[model samples]
Target: MKDVARVIVTYDCPRNCPNCCNEHIGDVPAVKFEDLLKYKELVITGGEPMEIAPRVVEMIHRLQANGYNGKLWLYTSCLKTTKWADRAVLQAVNGITYTLHHKPSQKDLSDVCKLNKYLLENLDNRAHDRSDRLLIDSRCYTEEVLRIIGLYDTGTKHWSSIKPLEWKDDECPIPDNEELIYYDLERV
Candidate 1:
């Protein structure tokens, strides 16, 4: 397997979600600044990255300061805290993989939809200095999520992997795919 420089910045999260693959807990020490220097591509993931947005932004800046010109990708659930809509936070990230959980609310959906729209709108805009950034759809297994994937895939490519969660005997459906991509902080 090709080695990718990936780090899980924190275990703490704001949401107690069910579909989460990485069941993170409380905060931990910040990622080592030096580890980021050696990696060509850095993936920053957590229970909720937005909760630690400032730290994430600072880490990115540190990497850039050290002359690391690689790509930066942030993984987030786009919860109330992970506000990708904020221009400042969006500016720091080169790309984002927004994961959507099953929460049906107009405001929540609208917020996510707005961020997606913004990413497309600003891709090539010279004014924002984000002409070279890439925005990818990284939604996982869900009917609604799949629909969004189909929509984005019509024109652009998105990343999707099968991740089967351990189910209890009383769980409604049985898993069909044996090879499920379980989340691991070390293997970003």
Candidate 2:
């Protein structure tokens, strides 16, 4: 059985990386926090959860206060960890997953590594091994649907009248409802 439930807390990310698959980043509903405790782990994600740092920390505290003992994993771009407030909020989580693709320079990579090392050294190690405390992924997910969410074919549309509007031939079709529920964010 899958014990982890990856929560899309918000779709408010500010980065414009080409491989983004989260189309709902600017206008998606936040997941109900209480609904997450039934799983063994809750992975909180957003356009950038740290974008609203305080709220995310409050939600984490709320989860703990409500007797949810499962791990709380956070997904981030590692852009705001340099800020003391954001760093504190991140350290509170049980584990962290960073999108390595977002690192634009050696400085960003160095910061990410330093932050991950600190997190691995400081957070409780009950549910995660030291090596598992931080995860870095080049592409957030390997699944085709998840790697290409906002893209669409504009066939027969206004400008496409000249030619069939097409997404990159390599692009994968978005999944239907049945396929979506089975997506494994932990693997991303």
Candidate 3:
């Protein structure tokens, strides 16, 4: 088994964003929970995992119960939903990388602030730098993104970044990098 695995919460998604990475995680057989135990890290991502928030919460519990000691991180846009701030979801993961969606509206920025506040209040462990993160989608890192990010900038932590968003391309990796970084993981 590889040292890392990106677990997709579901094959289906409501956003159905163009060139979404979920569409290109070519069949490698279903990655069972047990199969993931050997990994040093697990990144729970999705077609919006919050869509099945309960199942994700349970999955986190199950992984912990089975003695999976990896760092459990999650990736989500959290734009259309604030459920990511729910207590169970907040407490379970080691960290969360909230992607600030492209062309965000004022409501989107406000919602993110609310969610970050809830994360700080509910989990003391995450109150510091790096426990939670904010990333501006590279495609949308315009003046608007800067303005919105600055709205909530506490400046205590350098948490906001603008990385290339993940997308599917015939020869590109999930991070939308033109280079094929590593060979696809194949089970032993």
Top candidate when judged by TM-score against the true structure: 3
- Per-residue C-alpha lDDT of model 1 across residues 85-122, encoded as one tens digit per residue: 34555667665666555443555566555555555555
**Candidate 2, 1-188: lDDT as tens digits:** 25666566555666665645564223333334455556777667655777677777777777789899877667676546567767766667655655555334555555654554444355434434422232334333223322232113211111101111222333534323211112222222
Q: What are the RMSDs of all candidates, in order?
A: 8.6, 14.1, 5.9
- What TM-score, computed on C-alpha atoms, does each candidate reach? 0.58, 0.57, 0.71
Query: Deviation in angstroms for 89 in model 3?
Result: 1.7
Residues 20-113, candidate 3: write the lDDT tens digits.
Answer: 6655656635655567777787777766766667777777787789988878777777533355434577567777788776666687677666
After TM-score superposition, the amount by which residue 114's alpha carbon in candidate 1 deviates from its true location, in angstroms, is 1.0
TM-score of 2: 0.57
* lDDT, each prediction: 0.50, 0.50, 0.60
**lDDT of predicted model 1:** 0.50
List the candidate 3 regions with Cα displacement exceeding 4 Å: 79-85, 105-107, 119-130, 149-153, 156-188
Kindly give the number of clashing pairs for every candidate: 0, 3, 0
